[model samples]
Target: MAARMKRRDFIRRTALVGAGLLILRDPKSAWSYQANNRLNIAAIGAGGQGGGLVNIFAGMGENIVALCDVDDRRAAETYKRFPNAKRYKDFRRMLDELANSIDAVTVATPDHTHAVASIAAMKLGKHVYCEKPLTWCIGEARAMRKAAIEHKVITQMGNQGTASDGLRQGVEIVRAGVLGQVREVHVWSNRPVWPQGVDRPKDTPPIPPDLDWDLWLGPAPYRPYHPAYLPFVWRGWCDFGTGALGDMGCHTLNLPVMALKLHRAIAEGKTVVVEAEHSGCNGESYPKWSIVRYHFPARAGMAPLTLVWYDGGKKPPQEVLSLIPGEVPGSGCLIVGEKGMLYAPGDYATRWQLLPADQFRDFRPPAPFLPRSPGHHREWVLACKGENITPMSNFVDYAAYLTEIVLLGNLAIRLGGRIEWDAATARVRGRPEAEPLVHRPYRKGWTL
Candidate 1:
């Protein structure tokens, strides 16, 4: 009888494939998870990066139950490909009607809408995979973390490198103290790849018929429809996006945060200091170039350190560059420690090298401690089915704080002054002017 019961359980675990999508059966369904029998996935902002994400999930054999986007022209291909999937222009309506059917949602919307779309899904207990720099502002990042935890939902921020073996290994190495007291970190990006330091266009362009301009401007203040903010260029605008620091900081800064426990300051009720200097700020968009500094308070036995971020063709000083050999990459991270420096020569912390080769020629890496991921999206998919694995970049554990640290730099940049961040209170010390930036007022129709 025991043997027979075991066989039944094994067969019950078999995945169900419907419409060519896999619905991996689970031992138990948790957190309002409905995908144990049939995984029905939804994509918000289904065009460009959003479209690409839907395609990847589809390739994983997950049913695309719904696709939501504000622009019809941009999402044309996605709608055509997933004709069977219900389509909508507003994500709120999509979540309202299809909440029961969708087991998970992928939020690839522009930076500003990330918090709203993701928080709404989490409130309904649907698993969420949101794009990087989790939200447009620091308040939203905190809210995203709260929603994920309160709902007991599975969450993965879309910094895919969080799953890579190299990144995980790097984190483990740093935690193992192989680098011997990492004191300073420098992360640089070649962003603003679209455009920055430009005034808002004066000409009012016709809102494309396929686009719902109101929906596109969701939480942001009202603005006439303009071509400049559409498709992919929203990263530079103050109202629409979070610029270079928000665009790439989440990816480039992941290693240092995880390894050095940069979140320790906040966790321990400490404040972080941040300041920025930039090239020509026009008050409409981010500067063409900027350098920002973050001072984290010492906590959890780790010494205090400062992280410097450079963007818009900015690179680190030559003295710092001299530590690594050969051609310096366009974007990379450097962690300076008492013993030696560790360099990650890419946007994602997918690869690393112990610098000054001769000094470290005999060094052997510490044994890996962090569990290696089974692909980024797969980790989320598995967790959605109540699998034992959790995504490394899950909101409650990692992404929220990482995003908070990243957005703080932008606050300093836009405010053009030093910010004494009171993490415990989530306020700028003696800077009432930053209230608008910290806690943004939503339009009447929107809510986070």
Candidate 2:
């Protein structure tokens, strides 16, 4: 296997919890490695971003016990880096065989498989660090939060910006009324830097011998193997990926969503209106460009907000960009409050500026109330070791709900129209046709 390998590398509609917030820290895990203040970690997808995650965890001095990936070529780099780690073509097998040896797992798989893998690990009491836009569908997002809460496990979603001091400060600044009564938020992304706005290719190319075709299509309904769907291009595919909004919404919208308490607002209204306008729509892929609008009712002593998301060559109006000086960046967020807007000029929201530079020339940001992160992944590792620190993007408090909100845009895109979401029931309001997109049907072997 080493010689052949290339180099370098869920639908359960449960009652959605309202504002899924629970205790952030619990030193209750009984993993055997706890005695030594280390965790036996497993990487479910150890190549590309996944490989990067494995490298980070390993560098944190945790044990990398096993590795799983469907494509050997994609995983070659991780294999070279951790030759001793047991390898498997499927995560289910890896978890079953090494469950006892593993104390925690990091799931860097595609968005579709996130909930299943993370839930499976959590069911066995394994701490999990899954990548962002937590799950493919809203129901799965709800299930993820419920599972994490039930297991009482440490969990963090991989939106690295949540750990940045600047983002934390931005959140604090908004909450402190520095951006008083933020009623409008405009966020745009330079994404779908992948294939999109097209029908599925008719050709059935031979699956590479290095790839386990069936395993790679986990949970999602089966489709003929195509190169356009793999090696990171999957972001544009309707069946497998969540499109540009899903790809970048979690990051670009992170600041406004957190600062404005958008997730919590979902619980306040089942009629939260979501609508989208795009270049075009298709059954198999996302549009080339899209503008998704979400209507959020008043919550947390804040006013109502209409958060607008743009991607695939779309951006906020020139009026919104006028506040920021110089050339418009490819991706950024603008939070428009009564006082002034706070502009965070990157995906992570790690750097932000209060707009109308002259208005607050001497404006002072509020003192930080939120605890600083030890670094994105480090928070998870520390929490796994029973440290006092808790990751900001833990599934219970943040990730799952944020993911649900982000994926809602896809539902609107799928319908090419507005849909009201009933957060309480975990379904779309009076839209049975939209139900499938909320809780998707999986292939025979897959179970959510």
TM-score of each: 0.92, 0.93
Predicted candidate 2 versus true structure: per-residue lDDT over 1-448, tens digit per residue: 1112121101112321222344453336622233445568889899899999998888888778899999999999899999999999889988888876888898988888888899999998788999988999988988898888787788998889888899988988888888779788998888989989999999999999999988889988888898988989888898888999998888888878887888886655445789999988877899999999999888778898899999987888877777788787888988999988888887999898888889989988877777777899988877666555567788877888789889989999998778888887877877899888988887887885
Which lDDT tens digits does candidate 1 get at residues 160-262?
9988999887877777777788779999998979889999899997888888999889999998988898778899998989999899999999889888988
Off by over 4 Å in 1: 1-36
Name the candidate that leads on TM-score.
2
TM-score of 1: 0.92
| Distance from true location, Cα of 161 in model 2, Å | 0.5
What C-alpha lDDT, on a 0 to 100 scale, does residue 343 get in candidate 1?
94
